[model samples]
Target: MKGYVHSVESFSTLDGPGIRSVVFLQGCPLRCQYCHNPDTWQMNEGNLVDSAEVIARVLKNKNYIARNGGVTISGGEPTAQIDFLAELLKGFKEAGLHTAVDTSGYVDLDDIDRIIDDTDLFIVDIKHMDPEKCRELTGRSNEKVLALLGHLENLHQAVWIRNVLLPGFTDTEKHISDLCAYVQKLQNVQNFEVLPYHALAKAKYQDLDLPYKLDGISEFDSKQLLQYQDMIQKYYSKKFSIQHDAWM
Candidate 1:
């Protein structure tokens, strides 16, 4: 088996638990406005490597994973190549490695199940609670994403819900409140991470020759992020905290 891979980041820490190898799969179905990986959205475009070839490299980093965390698959939307992802996860699981997938939940439930059975963690991104706003922010509606979340819940899969806190897009009080309320209903959610938006990917957009959509949009204020974090905690606090240090 083979997969189209955009890039590989060995010894990545922020993607998942401890140390991890992040396989950035190519191709994404959703066009997110604040996407840092805009260059990865192109379908059928990337270096094709056989499963064994990739596994060989992954094994080299096994010690790092064991000592820290494990392996994490992030992507333009890893679900875009579902079967390849499942096979890769199977390899890692058999090696006794902790596996996690960072996804937008935009793929089919069948595909999700194929990998979820082997995956230990699901870092799901819920862009917006309002369907229309979700569609506007990311060219696709949240129906499929939400459906996938429901499936995870029903199957009792562990999940960490992530919402990129954007200034004008996803920071409104009404939206955050609704999102927190919705998340509270999901008993399977192990944690919630609120990521503050940064313009660190602006140069990447230029490199890809793609127009930067939120040019004038400033970075989210640290103070506001805490406000939202506190608000969300008020509703769902089993495990909720800022990605970095406490905002205040």
Candidate 2:
């Protein structure tokens, strides 16, 4: 099956462990106000290519990626196109490349079950824990996301949880503390990160004729990440890092 692709990054260190070939699939269910790539919001708006084609292109750098990293299926929301994502993940695995899916975990269990076996890791986005706040930020409740996280925990799937710390939203002390505590309950967490929010996508929104929802919000200072690290480190004693411009 063909997948609608927003773009592809041949090499990326931020999406997952080691170096990775990141495939940005098209479409999303939520309209996250601080989304950096609003250009990828539409499911049918991108170039369509066969899953085999995407696999072949990524495999070209197989010697390096396979040895160091692997393939990462990221998106607007990779699971939005379940069939295409499954095909791509399966293809990556069959070719002996490690595979990871970076997603919002906004999809249903049955839908994502297709790729669970093929996916070696899941980088789940934690938009906001409060249902109302989450809905306000992304136009959806946090129900699905929570469910997906629980599912992954039950399966013992390796996960990297991330939250974009936006001002007046997810940057609150209570939010960070609760988020950190919640993550501690998971057994297979590989990484926990807080992506510093930035207004880097304002230009994209302006170009797309979409209103910059967060027009006045200043870029989140990278230094503020340290305070959060210190606060959450008590709960998350494993791997935690201050994510700069690297989170999707």
Candidate 3:
């Protein structure tokens, strides 16, 4: 199977456990206002290549990934091209590497089922808890996101929940509380991370000729992130550490 690939990170310690090879695929459904990789929005823009070709490249750097780390197929919403993603995941498994998919979770269960078995972990992004608020920020409803999360729960799939802390939108007390409440419902969550927002994508938006909706927003103070752990403990009890150290 073939798919459009935006880029590749040969050694990324922040994308997942240990060191990993990150396959940045092209295409995303949600137009997240604070998105950093706006270049990946167009489905057909990136270089098209077969799954085997991508796998071969990743395996070439396999020794760099060592034992714990493996492969992560990230996106512009990787699930946007389910068949291609499934093929890549299947290849990773056949090669005896741990597999993971970093997704927005705005996907159909049927589509997710294609790669679910092969994926060792799911790095899910939960943008907003309120459907209307989610729509306002992402230009899409959170219904599909929640549905996909629920499906993963049923399968007892390993999940790492991620939420970007946008200053005015997602950093409010109510917003965080609502997110914590929802996360409490799931018993299979391995980690819950609140990513501090960064406006490093300003130039990218300007270059792409797209309006930067989060124009004046400043980067979040990551040091203050520890306070959220106490808030999360009120509703759920599990790991609540910062997982996006790569951005730092």
Models 1 onward score TM values of 0.94, 0.97, 0.94
Collision pairs in model 3? none
Tens digits of per-residue lDDT for model 1, 1-248:
98899888888767777889888899999999889888889868888988777777888989878766888888899989888898899998898889999999898998887787799999999999888999999998899989999999999999988888888878888888888889989999887888888888889999888898899998757687677777777777577767753110
TM-score of 2: 0.97
lDDT for position 112 in model 3? 87
On lDDT, the candidate that comes out on top is: 2
Worst 10 residues of 3 by lDDT: 239-248
Task: Indicate the worst ten consecutive residues by lDDT in candidate 1.
Answer: 239-248
lDDT tens readout by residue for model 3, 37-145? 9999999989999999999999998887849899988989999988899999999999989998999988889998888889999999999999999999999989999
For model 2, what is the error of residue 143's alpha carbon versus the real structure, in angstroms, after optimal superposition? 0.5
Candidate lDDT scores, in order, read 0.85, 0.89, 0.86
**Global Cα RMSD, each model:** 2.5, 1.2, 1.7
